[model samples]
Target: MTSTTLRGVTIDYDDLGPPAGLPVLLVHGHPFDRTLWAPQARALTGAGHRVVTPDLRGYGRSGVTPGKVLLADFADDLAALLDHLGIERAVVGGVSMGGQIAMEFQLRHPRRVRALVLSDTSAAAETDEGKRFRNRLADRLLAEGMDGYAYEVVDKMLADYNVTAMPDVAARVLEMMCATDPRGAAAALRGRAERPDYREVLAAVEAPVLIAVGADDAYTPVAEAEAIHRLVPHATLAVIEKAGHLPGAEQPERFNAALLEFLAAQV
Candidate 1:
């Protein structure tokens, strides 16, 4: 329920971890919200790092803008959120589309980023198949409505981990995804599906970077993680065994351990 004015948009966020601890910002991907980072946040906090999870524009309790918004706006909003919280610099991590945002944010605001984590994300432009996949899915959403969209999204992202093996965690993620504004979700994807190439930016990143992906992730495959690692000057890639696209929820123990260890090296 907490909110802050970031470039006229009221950014909604849940600030966890200890106030005195090193700040870590967690950004969730499409069709989900701040809650996606709950498990990771709790574990990071227990390890003495502050965690801040925000509901991106048009997701969860955050207000939706009238039309589609570019990912740059999301990055700007993140900067404002950090400024509002009086955090000068901190570790930033993102999953899926959120990882893209985190990458761009680090590129534009290097001084504000102490470290970077890209979880199950790629730096390449969307393939034609990717665009077609999104278009077909959008068509389905227009035809079947939010209920159908929710089912389809959950099936794609959470089925491999949350549903079959981790029902409780899956349910929590579904709750957040289903609660989102379907129109907002579609619009976010519509605008984001065409993001530019980030390889050069990735190579230019001087901050310590950690590229991670689930071994079982079918969406953003492990190859994407390797690709990112190849581009970054000294980025490290860690694979979480037996996990899916949403490693933060499916394999949080491993994800948190890798994240904490990488962050510790930065200190």
Candidate 2:
């Protein structure tokens, strides 16, 4: 557990593995904290890669200021984090909303990213309908609270196999969502609704890109990953079976294996 001040906001992050090892930054999605990367961090560190996972402004124990947070704000916070840690560059990865932030970070600080690992995410921006839906969700969260949202999405978050066979995993995810501060979560949703399409950004990514998604991801879906893989100049794709949006926790072994293979090729 460690902390840093970025743009007047306190950012909470976990720094693992030897300082001299190859650096990799893993960002978590909305309604979740940095702890979401625990499974992957352990695996990556054990494989000799330096793993850094940080909680974005609204989530976790990081800054909880009341305001609209642009996706670029998340990117700037990441750049500030790397600068604070004296890191020149790293392999950046994220899932869902975190993946969108990763794209924003790469666009904001190109020289700081060596490679990209986009998991269960998309390259498209929020559609007008999507924005309206998200705004309604934000309003609901701010008005009613996270309980309704958490319960409603828990089943949607994981695959049917997970919801049935992996009750503990499902429960943990629910806890993470329910534990989130309503205000912060609402702010994140509002900001996310404004994220721009990254397909054009993918065309600009010259670094190695590994796009992985669950075979049964209902939200991002496999086709979204395919679209990203097709757009990135240098990209590879992996699909883990029996997993949903959060494959890192649901299918860590397969996810780690694919990620390790990619990292090995780089280092």
Candidate 3:
């Protein structure tokens, strides 16, 4: 892992594979670090692609901000990271909140995105109830820390079957969440509550898109993925079975296969 200062914050990241290989940037979701993409990173790098995974601000080894951190802020950090690495463009991908960040990146830096991969995420703006819930959750996190919340959501993050069948993945997911700084998590939640609707932004995308979601994902179900597909008519959609929100980690083989095929034929 390497560390760099972008936008006055220290960002920790891993740049793997040959420097000349086609670049693929994968972002992790809320409360998780770059390790969420560990399996995918290894697979992509082995397939001769340069994989970049970063621990977003307040997650993993990255610096934390006490206040809110907007999706646009996250997108700018990524753009700055790419500029620092001297990369002109890359296949930008993310999971859940990371997927939303990817959308923000596409909206802000269209020329720097070669293609897009959005997994288990939505483009709709937060509703009034959602805003209230997010703010309340943020307050809860700040007040109580992450243990209880992490434990409660672990099963939802992965399918209940995954907790029993793939203990290692379950443990990793929980660890990432439990270890996250509450201030950062709260800040992210607060910012996410104010995110704009991206339906039209997605509809205007000229770059190739790949939408992958777990069939059992309760957080962002296959219906949400279908909605994204509808917006981006030319996108390739893959629904991984026996997986939930974090399908790339829960069902790495299937997820990697879909990703590899997309990169080979589309990007």
Candidate 4:
């Protein structure tokens, strides 16, 4: 893992694959780190595409601070990361909250994103009730820390198929969840609850889009993916079966099949 300072925040990221290869930036979701894309990164890098995975603002290997943050703050952080690497444009991909950030990145820095991969995520604005629920989650984390919360939500964060058939993936998910900084996790959750409606942004994104979802994903189900597919022009959709919210980890083979095929068609 490598660390760099951007806007006074210490950002930790992993830069792998050929230096001159087509750039591919992978962003991790809330309560997870760049490790979330471990499997996919290896495949992408081995396939000759530069893979850069970053620990989002308040997540793993990065700073741990509690403050008000918006989705744009996270998006801008990525733009800054790419600039630090001297990358003008790259294929941007993210899972869950990371996916939302990718969409936000397209909106904020259009020329910086050559393509998009939105995985197990949604583009809708956080509803009023959703905001309150997320705030309460933050409150719980600050009050009790991540132990119980991590275990309790592990099943939901992962799919049923993952819990039963992918024990190794489940363990890793639990490990990352347990290691989450309460303040950082809380801040991220709160920040995510304030993310903007990207439906309009999705429709406007000129880059080709790929929307991938775990068939069993409960948080951002197939319906959500379909809705996003309808909005994103030139977008492709793939629903990986026998996986859940974290399909990239739960079913890497299938996930990578769709991803690599997509990349091969691009630069």
TM-score top scorer: 3
> What is candidate 1's TM-score against the reference?
0.93
Off by over 4 Å in 4: none
Off by over 4 Å in 3: none
**Considering lDDT, where higher is better, how would the candidates rank from best to worst?**
3, 4, 2, 1
The C-alpha stretches of model 1 lying farther than 4 A from their native spots are 139-143, 159-162
Candidate 1 structure quality by residue, lDDT tens digits, 1-267:
488878877789988778889899989998789988888888888888888999999888888874566778788899999999999998999999999999879877889999999999988877888878876765665556666666666656853645767888777877877788776677677668777788888899888999999887888888889889888997889999878888878888898889889988876
Backbone clash tally for model 1? 0
- Pick the lDDT winner: 3
Error of 4 at 255 (Å): 0.1
**Candidate 2 whole-model C-alpha lDDT, 0 to 1:** 0.90
- For model 2, residues 39-154, the per-residue Cα lDDT tens digits are 89999999899999999888888988565788898989998899999999999999998899999998899899999999999888889999999889888999998988888887
Task: Give per-candidate clash totals.
Answer: 0, 0, 0, 0
Model 2: ten consecutive residues of lowest lDDT: 63-72
lDDT of 3 by residue, 1-267 (tens): 999999999999999998988899999999999999999999999989999999999899999998899999999999999999999999999999999999999999999999999999999999999999999999999999999999999889998889999999999999999999999999999999999999999999999999999999989999999999999956999999999999999999999999999998643
Q: What is the TM-score (0 to 1) of candidate 3?
A: 0.99
